[model samples]
Target: MEKIAQPQSSFMKLCRKLSPKRKDSAAESQHIKNGDHDKNRHIEAVFAYMDANKDGRISPDELQKSFMTLGEQLSDEEAEAAVRLSDTDGDGMLDFEEFAQLIKGDDKCSEEEKKMELKEAFKMYIAEGEECITPRSLKMMLKKLGESRTTDDCRVMIRAFDLNDDGVLSFDEFALMMR
Candidate 1:
């Protein structure tokens, strides 16, 4: 049998109440024109992939750890807040249904748009319009983001995602890390 979306939890209701209604712009209209079926499937797959333990729900701890893996340090409170916003079943965790519902209304960007955004972010890590990021530049950038890492640590971090083994991070490598 097909599962139905759960009734919205109080947290979800409150989020709805606080969220301002956006007037759809040209971009929003274009997004609507592009079908969301594939996007929905992708979101579902991602949710399942993130649920790591196959527990049918994602805990705040899992979310926090995932953020850390991506170099984003989230405080316990911040992680809990994120879970609360999406926990539409009042279970303190997110099932696939709740996850789907939570992201169903999101403005899903096109692959091209995503690439462009990644490229723009990659540009920020480059110096003097250089095409790639050296370990020194990467360390400086990470330091700017409040992450204190030694040059060796930065090199290690780059090598972790540096597919070409060129001793630096290219735009493609950076995009892979971002994705």
Candidate 2:
């Protein structure tokens, strides 16, 4: 028992008014079904993940608040930085759904190269100096490995893990490096 997909009657009427050539140009099956709707639902799910406010859209304010709510308070400066960096649409606000789509859709890798790149990135970011991965060892490893980054002249590496700005790397933030 397969399901079916149906365009609204209004859409069907509009299609009929078009010339035969135009009518079939769209080539929509009148009985289209569940799979199409399922795709829409998946889209909604992605949107929901990014919509912290549940306001139906993802505004910069909402995004900032969501991050802030997650204990990552963005100073006004940081919020501005984030918006400038992430609001790809330049729409001045991100809809919850669109924002969700952006993150998931923003795969900066070709599938074929993903595994190799991931391995290299993990090797650089992770510290396995000791029997197990540990924060102290990880930081040291990053600082040493980052010495050769394009900005090789400066010790600007390993600074990103100090989430609290406490001049020390926390355990959880170190874990994020695995990502």
Candidate 3:
């Protein structure tokens, strides 16, 4: 693969910096020691985006719409359930604190379950009988997600997350990128 000299977008830089290697205890401990302020800031940004009406709360409709914008089909019932799970004050909406807590609680899922979800997502970009994500597969997935990038751009993205330097993303690399 020919290495392309593409300027990294801020989002891409953040993704690159945040990509965790398998069992990188040092990085994990650093994130914990720093009090996860960056993570909290990201959560706050997401909350702001989901609060479509700017009422300082996320309603079920807003949640559903926000997820839809991200290409995830969040049904109304599922959104209501999510709000109920986090709406501690019985307000039927998610305030910033409640939203933060809800996201934090997502970490409670078992490692096995998380791995299964990651595996399923990884499968979306791989061909039948393939075990890794090549630039071609990634380009196709990115196009499906409404982002049009050249194959070289996809190669650059894969290189950013390809810890093994093999010009492709294995399941472990994909899991690390998701982290």
Predicted structure with the largest TM-score when compared to the true one: 3
Best by lDDT: 3
C-alpha local distance difference test of each model: 0.59, 0.39, 0.66
* 11 Cα displacement, candidate 2 (Å): 37
Candidates' RMSD to native: 12.8, 20.4, 9.9
Q: Model 1, poorest ten-residue lDDT window?
A: 1-10
Estimate candidate 3's alpha-carbon lDDT, on a 0 to 1 scale.
Answer: 0.66
lDDT of 3 by residue, 1-179 (tens): 01111111111222222222323235576567454765666666666766889999989898778656544565677777777876899999989998777666555556665666566567767866779999998887666545688999989989998998999999998877776
Model 2: colliding residue pairs: 4-32, 4-33, 5-31, 5-32, 5-33, 57-96, 58-94, 58-95, 58-96
As a whole number from 0 to 100, the lDDT of residue 16 in candidate 1 is 22
lDDT of 1 by residue, 64-148 (tens): 6654543445568766776677687788998877776665533354566446545655665667657898888877766654467
How does candidate 3 fare on TM-score?
A: 0.68
State the number of backbone clashes in model 3.
0
